[model samples]
Target: MPEETQAEQVEPQPQEPETAPEADGRTDPWSDPEAARREIEKLRREAAGHRTKVRELEPLAAKAKELEDAQKSEAERLTEQLAAERERAAAATRSAVAAKVEALAAKTFADPEDAAGALDLTAYVDESGVIDRDRIQADLAALLERKPHWGRPDDGPRRPAPDRTQGSSGNGNRTPSDPANDFANWFKHSLDQAR
Candidate 1:
């Protein structure tokens, strides 16, 4: 065996491990489950308290808003009313145009709804809200020309009303619709019943 040198023969001395920096004395939630649970509970309580506060303040906030609206200037109130009236007027104009379109389209188109939907109608109403009937007619003509099938056909689905279907099975009791036949059927049925 080779002679052991003094350097090699010295045993390894165990040194103390370096201490980690201080952790602000707080428990690591991952390491302490109870601490994590307590923290969650505290947060929940705080959230509940905030919610209760909000509930108490809601009525006051609504009253404040109501007061603010009530204190508005007469001009501001009139402006609001004017805006609402203008909206209604626009809606009425559109409705009037739609009704006219529906009635007119029904004359040429098999499905008035389809024709009404297909037409670009915004231009039919002028800035003054007067409907331009001439423009609407022109547009309808152009649409019918572009899509010929949208127009009603002379021989399409307008067949004569179907006769009410009579039961064809030759077996069931036939109730006579005519009063003269009813008396004859009653006698015949009574005889058959006796048999």
Candidate 2:
């Protein structure tokens, strides 16, 4: 083994040129600064055109959103109105049923209160708000037949005739002296005798 001098160690070496590898045997456009700048400028122009299109459509998009909101609000208001109308109709139906029941009860029973208490409104009234009069009458008849006491006159007992002798003038079987005083005396006499 021999030691080599520094001049012999420093032998000239062959150099290769620096170059980018070609993809599919074609040059990349990005390798040229001018081509890259042109590509960037083209992209910027396309972007500007897109921005202009978006700006042009903005008002139409806003109008469409506003219209949709207005329609939704109107639909909500109509729904509320319909609900209110249905409530009013239901209340009116109930009122009509009540009036009919009260009238029928008054007609059927000696004491209207007794009839009102005994009657079932639900049984007579249909879902469509129609009342069954025949059913109501039949029910009333059945009730009256079952409870005979309910049909009796409420005005308790009758009073006996007054005795004329107690309030009459001195003559044993006398007529009043004046015709005008006769009616007045008879009325007074009847009231006093009854008491």
Candidate 3:
């Protein structure tokens, strides 16, 4: 047990060289070319297996993408169809309202445009496509009451006054004053005399 300096006190032992791990974990195969070749072949087999799996799934992936695209196109077509249907419905409704307004005005007044201008057509039509006739009549009556001049006379278009001179006989004698002794009756009498 003599005292020794730090460098001298330490003794170096024979060291084993470190090598890379093998597949079996028991031996270092780097030194043997045959073992390295076997490992490379094993890795190549594994890579081939992975490639085979990817090949098997390729068709399925393509089919899934195709189905997704089909569904998207179908949805877009349905959306366009819905929009077209809505436009058609709106146009039909507008035409129906205009026809109804024209018919109502013609039935109630002399001037259809003036009658249409006085009432709200939307109010008289319900969602169920039923027209409120009573309400329309009431509204029309109220309108006529408010503007009394809007009421059309029950008598139709006026006719010109009859020409009394045309009914006189050519013999310088005036026709009878009786209501039935008009030009028509006198013409019938002259025709009977000729027969």
Candidate 4:
């Protein structure tokens, strides 16, 4: 094979015109320096505004969380308090009813000692007139001055005396005229008897 000469090695080349149309026929959007700069500034400002909004929202989110936590805590506390109150009320009711039942049993049996032995005092009375230990205890404690005993019917319960100073003159066998006063007295009496 002969060595190729320099002129032969150089290939003929064709040249096109310097002016040409863009492939998509569109100019660069950033060709306007001022407009491009303004666009960049606008983007920067928008980003800054977004950051500011985020900062502002952080505190609001935190406050919302705090409020939610506080509400949950308050709700829990209230629920516990309500449960405790209900338990207290139930206990009071049971005790009062028991006292009434004991008193009723003593009267019905006509023998305090025998009545106590024979009765499950809570079962003797209902809201209407059922006899139960709880009812007996409540009635005796509320109505009687002396504590009721089951040993023997030596004497009947001592009824409360009317206050002469208050001009209250009743046989004392009936409940007080004022419902609140009556309930208070009865509850106090029931508590004492239970103890």
Candidate 5:
């Protein structure tokens, strides 16, 4: 409850100045404009060296781009060449298939009479040897125009029909033609359902 002394209430003050280190009368190196100019000059020299390096590498960068472009062009050329080769191979395969078809047709129509009277021979055959519907139709038209009398069903001319008589199995005795013989070896409709 006694009164507080003024000296006890007062705080101690620091001896250091509130400003920078220049209070000691010594100049800071960064404060000199001429020294700062020298530092800036050094930085500019380093930047100039970097600029020189960039200038020197410019041709290399351009060459790398050129190489990349060349590689791309070569890849495109190879892709085109591969596609063309595949097309050629496909064409060759088609040609081989056509040849095989021609061989089969020749085997089917061995006789001239069979070629003329049986199925017109040209109805399902084409010049390309393939059984294309449009090509076969054209060939059939040509054959009909060439042989008008051959396709005439109304012509009463007695042409000898081919010997389609079925032989007996094991019996040596020959029997007469059966009344139902016409339906025995009839051509099925399943043979004409192709596209």
Candidate 6:
């Protein structure tokens, strides 16, 4: 075995790193802890910078969209406005139709819920959103004829007799005879019951 010089040992060490298994041609920071930390810090700073740029651009983007809208041709703007008006008008029409339907249903159905579940309200409105009052009245009349029970149970309070004073004789204990001379008989009857 030969004794090696320090300079010779150091000389081969510099070349070994190039052919070392741990070495690769790439420059990514994963191979070095300090380099990875610096790279992570740099990426964080770049992300913060991009975030600030996005924040700065936010108002400009809104303004650009506004300007684009402002610069639209009159026909285009008018078309959009007309479309919005049409949508609002349609909503108004639907609301009006629903109100009318509810009012009509309240008059016709004994139960308001029955009108909601049993009837197809669209049948009362034409394509132009005009309600057909005649048709609704006729249909309700027809429904009452088909299912007579569906109508409001007669208009007054339900009771066994109309006037409470009418057909009721005096307290049911005595016969339907004059009571002027019946005190003794009534007393004896009461005593008998008490026994």
lDDT of 1 by residue, 105-178 (tens): 88888888777788766779988778888888888888999999999887657778765445654756654378
Candidate 4 C-alpha error for residue 179, in Å: 54
The segments of candidate 6 whose C-alpha lies over 4 angstroms from its true place after superposition are: 1-80, 116-118, 126-129, 142-150, 156-195
lDDT of 2 by residue, 86-183 (tens): 99987786666656656776755677657656777667778777888888778777888888777746666889888665685766686547877888
What ranking emerges by TM-score with the best candidate at the front? 2, 1, 3, 5, 4, 6
Q: How much RMSD separates candidate 2 from the native structure?
A: 16.0
lDDT tens digits, residues 1-195, model 3?
132253244454444465667678867644555554567667767988999999999999999999999999999999999999989986676557656665765765667667668777778778887777777677777877787666666787789898866764776776547666677798999999999
Relative to the true structure, candidate 1 reaches a TM of 0.48
Give the per-residue lDDT digits (tens) of candidate 5, residues 1-70. 1212543443544333333558678555455544444676677679889999999999999999999999
Candidate 5 colliding pairs: none
Residue 179 of model 1, lDDT score: 80
For candidate 5, report its TM-score.
0.38
Predictions in order: lDDT: 0.76, 0.72, 0.72, 0.61, 0.56, 0.67
**After TM-score superposition, what is the CA distance of residue 62 in candidate 1 from its true location, in Å?**
24
What RMSD does model 6 have? 17.0
Per residue, candidate 6 scores C-alpha lDDT tens digits across 1-195 of: 122243234322222222234446556555555555567668867988999999999999999988887877666989999999999987786666556655676765687555445556666777877888778667767777887776666668767757544565677553555576588789989999999
Q: Which ten residues in a row have the lowest lDDT in candidate 3?
A: 1-10
Worst lDDT run of 10 residues, candidate 2, spans 1-10
Model 2 lDDT, full chain set: 0.72
lDDT of 4 by residue, 104-168 (tens): 65553445444454445445546664445455555444444343443345666887897754644
Better of 4 and 6 by TM-score: 4
lDDT at 178, model 5: 67
Off by over 4 Å in 2: 1-32, 108-129, 135-195
